[model samples]
Target: MKEAILAAIKAYDTIILHRHVRPDPDAYGSQMGLATIIQASFPEKQVFSVGNDEASLRFLGKVDEIADELYQDALVIVCDTANTARISDRRYTAGKMLIKIDHHPNDEPYGDLVWVDTSASSCSEMIVSFYETFQEELTLHEEAARLLYAGIVGDTGRFMYPSTTSETFRLTAKLVHFPFDRPALYRHLYEQSLPMTRLAGYILEHFQMEEGGAATVFLPEELLTRFEVDPREASGLVNVIDSAVGLKAWIMFIQEGDVIRARLRSKGPVINELAKEYGGGGHPLASGATIHTLEEMAEMKRKLIAICLETV
Candidate 1:
């Protein structure tokens, strides 16, 4: 798959990169890191990273303005997105050739060439490994290494999550050979504003646990307005319940306008299947879903509780 993707890259004069919507560190990291490597390798080719406007992690790379016509003869490389709907820019299909590079489990493989490595800790890690595959011919500098390392660290939860592996550490070790401020990266990724901190406090006080160790944090429309912070930003507060002993699973619902976006996590159960039931799918341990109405939210909450209890 890497060779096929490389062939496509060599064939195209213009290459475009993309990631999922509501970009996370891993999303931006893989997108930017690959773009940097490609630009470094083929300085003659024109490469652009396109997606929904860059948000929180734009510091990794500035989102570029791209004309739709440019994609007519381009090779679109989508990183970290599981499916087409999750893609930030739908223009990917318009490209002359499409490539999918991701670590998430593939459901509906959309690309002309697909490379999905579920064992890879993160897409950035996969990108690093991809570079290592062609090391004799390609060069990885600080710009690519730092962003890829940040993606690896972010997705692995600083090596605390179950996804962290020996290869994850080894890949990261290779990146450190390049010069970048690791401490500053942490500050940028983990540090939060005062309002967001207060929002975390609110979640702590408000989240409730049900029978059989299922926990939930629901941010209704009003509370979201009260907080004056994007509900997506508050999504990280779901970590507050990670220390809960005996908890099988947890879900936090953040109201995003018409739909309630769920960030679901599990210590034991396979919840990505459940996420698929609720209109989303991601990794088995960490996944997300979108609920249409209050009724669906209640329905999903009950179903998650059942999963926790092993009653369903």
Candidate 2:
């Protein structure tokens, strides 16, 4: 990991950070945390975090936007994303060197130097651990600490996921020293608006569970418009199905125009390989795919159900 970081810093005077599109707290956290570290450590170098506009996560931090003219000889560091297709910006490849740091199970390497560990709970955890190894020479600022904390908390479901380990807690302990309000962060995360709460209730009540405890929910785009909630507000719905009792696997398909966006998750046994089959990628426990029509997504879900039945 140090080799990759050092090589990137030495190769380019400017560093641009990127993560997956449709920004989540974890993606935003890792992006902000690493950019903060590089900027604070090497004051002479210019580091930028570029991706989507992130209208929802604006409170976390603002992403830097540099013109395309600045792309020459720049180093692009992509964090937390498993596939190049999911990366927020394809323009990142214009950089002289690409560096990837991720904790997802897939080994679809997209960078000159790749550091991927499936055992880690989140990519932010991997970044923090690697930084700690160089703690003697590097520093951790409050901005970096808070952002890292947000990633750790978000990805691990506040340490509820099976991937959480002793190292995760150890790193959490270290990050708290920077002095951020824990309660406020938790509130911003767990607290939802009344409309969102109502939407969630509707989703849960309408959810259907097949044999072998595989649950599924299909949300039409019209429902989102009716509730005045954006796509980001629907992010937690798949996770909610994942926590349902006796659910071996779950899927959430949202209809938007001609496309049907699907989020797949499983607790055990069943391997829902829908992501790779349908032009997306992520971990075994969590994956996503978007298809041209609901019929296509339904066929994919049917395949997943067949796999789950065979496993059972």
Candidate 3:
């Protein structure tokens, strides 16, 4: 991974950084942080962060993107994306060299050198490893440090997620040395607006649980329109519902314009492989898919219920 990164840095005159679409904090953070580091270190080279916007991840930094014509001799660094389809831009393939850095359970290689470790809490953690390996030569500026720190905390649920480890903390401790207020970041992440709070309450009121303790919440198009929360804000609502009493697994059914988007989560042995069945995929513990209507979501819930019951 280090060699690939170093090679790409040295080989290409123009470096383009990209991440997943509808990006979570980690995805945007890693891209901004790594791009900042590269640009600061190698001022002679042209570095650009592409395919991200300021809407979803506005807290991190100014998101930058360049035109497709610029990818001719660019070395692309793809961060925090597991699958090719999830990559925000298809023009990444046009780069002179491709390097993928991710933390997902995939064996397939996406670029010249692929680093995929499911055990790492997030790609930002693995990027920290690279920073450490090149510590002698690299100095993480304040912007890079802040962005990386946000990625670490966001993806690890503030270090509460299971994937967090000694290495995660060690790297995080190193990152904190750079100046950024931790409290401010936390506030921006967890604090809720009035609309968001009301939306959460409404979703909570509609929660249901199966006989086997699998929780489910179905949000019809009307409710979503009434609340005005973007689909991004409603990203992992099922996981929130899973905190209900005796909950083992959970599902959130959201009605988009013409489709029902499903988010699934499992505690144990409750594999929601519905993502795989419906042309989407993620970890067994967390997955998602989109269906045509409420009836299709009900059918998927039935499948998930069967899986949860068998686990119990």
Clashes of each: 0, 0, 0
RMSD of each: 1.6, 1.9, 1.7
**CA deviation > 4 Å runs, candidate 2:** none
Give the C-alpha lDDT of model 1.
0.89
lDDT of 2 by residue, 228-306 (tens): 7766568666776566777788788887677777888888744546677888667777778778886786787687777
For candidate 2, the 10 contiguous residues with the lowest summed lDDT are 267-276
lDDT-better candidate, 1 vs 3 = 1
| Model 3: lDDT to the true structure | 0.80
Task: Give the lDDT ranking, best first.
Answer: 1, 2, 3
Q: Tell me which of candidates 1 and 2 scores higher on TM-score.
A: 1
List residue ranges in candidate 3 displaced over 4 A. Answer: 270-272
What is the lDDT, from 0 to 100, of the residue 31 in candidate 3? 86
Model 1: how far is 221 from its true place, Å? 1.5
The TM-score measured for candidate 1 stands at 0.96
lDDT for each candidate structure? 0.89, 0.82, 0.80
lDDT of 3 by residue, 1-312 (tens): 687678679778899889998787789888888888888888888998878474646878766757878999889989998888899878889998888889876735699878787888888888788888997776688888889989989888889867789999999898898778889988887777676688788877878878787778888777877888766667645555656778887778887778878888777854546677887677767777888866777788788777778886
Local error of candidate 1 at 66, Å? 1.5
Best of the candidates, lDDT:
1
lDDT comparison, 1 vs 2, better candidate: 1
| Candidate 1 lDDT, 190-263, residue by residue in tens | 98888788888888888888988889989987887788888777787778778877778999999988989999
